[model samples]
Target: MKQPEIIFILRGATGAEHLALEGAVNLEARLSDPDRRRALVAGFYGFHADAEYCLAPWLEPVEGLDFAARRRLPRIGADLVALGGKPAPSRERPTVTSLGYALGLFYVLEGSSLGGRVIHKQLSHTDVDQRGLSFFDPYGDQTGAQWRAFIAVLDREHAAGRADSKEIVAGALDGFRLARMWLTE
Candidate 1:
């Protein structure tokens, strides 16, 4: 069996990005608090029975109301304060076509480091996993050469300081919180 530390070491991100992970042991319950719930709703998570999913700011075809409105539940988006840079796109209802540019491609799509292996390792094979839970998981199918070229872009962005550890951590939390809070609340 793999030890927790071993898995953590394999995650390939810096420690700062995983700082909140310790809190997740408790955050699952805290995420249900009414205040946090309100924060989530205000942040634009739409509800579905036991899961609240983000509409990705650019991907349409999401299957729920955009607001709580007494008819649905909501979840929080990233806490930009903690994310360190790059705020989420605004809440206006411009056409979906406009959203890709409005939100920026990097925010919506990962070129090479799509969370594929990570998602599989984390949720698959867990006892209570509900399985098939990663419909929103990131994916990329380019050849190795193509992938290398793509990762170079993320590297450039990082070198330029356009992206950072804090933003990655906060957004990852928002993603899971938006999903798991539904079961608790």
Candidate 2:
């Protein structure tokens, strides 16, 4: 059976998602406290900074896909400071290059915002979470719109025969593994 490209990517990433969620348990535990939230945000900042830096060069030239506009590092950094913590430094290296590769990685990164919304809701009333949830849902009310736009672009790319489902899956899988390692390590 044929599936939408996004669906295909999602199915391919099931294992990676499970692996990444193992690390998320720690973050989930920390969200109950303000100080721990700071450390959690710092850890997230480090992971994202590295991923965004590595993917930016390749994704920059893609129209309607401005990597800068989508970045959470600056906000994450500020959130870390507000929480009385320094921004965590990225220790991971770039794992993929090329536009196709970046897009695949982006699928995982951008998809995270959807789940972030759920977490944001859970933490919305907390003082620290209120201040730091920007990394989770940078677009706020516009998150759905932004996700739809990204999916639209993916559809277009697929229709134009520029999308490589396998590469995208590989990117997403690698992204998940890398994120898990960074968050836990």
Question: Which candidate leads the pack in TM-score?
Answer: 2
lDDT by residue for model 1 (8-114), tens: 32244334433443344343233345444344333323322212223344223212212222112211223222322222343332222332221122222232123
TM-score of 1: 0.28
RMSD, each candidate, Å?
13.5, 2.9
User: lDDT for every model?
Assistant: 0.31, 0.73
- Clashes within 3 Å, all models in order: 2, 0
Candidate 2 local lDDT, 59-113, one digit each (tens): 7777787778988788888878878888765677667755556777787778788
Candidate 2 residues lying further than 4 Å off, grouped into runs, are: 1-3, 15-23, 125-129
Q: Which ten residues in a row have the lowest lDDT in candidate 1?
A: 66-75
Predicted model with the maximum lDDT: 2
Candidate 2, run of 10 with poorest lDDT: 1-10
- State the local distance difference test value for candidate 1: 0.31
Pairs with steric clashes in candidate 2: none
Q: What is the TM-score of each candidate against the true structure?
A: 0.28, 0.85
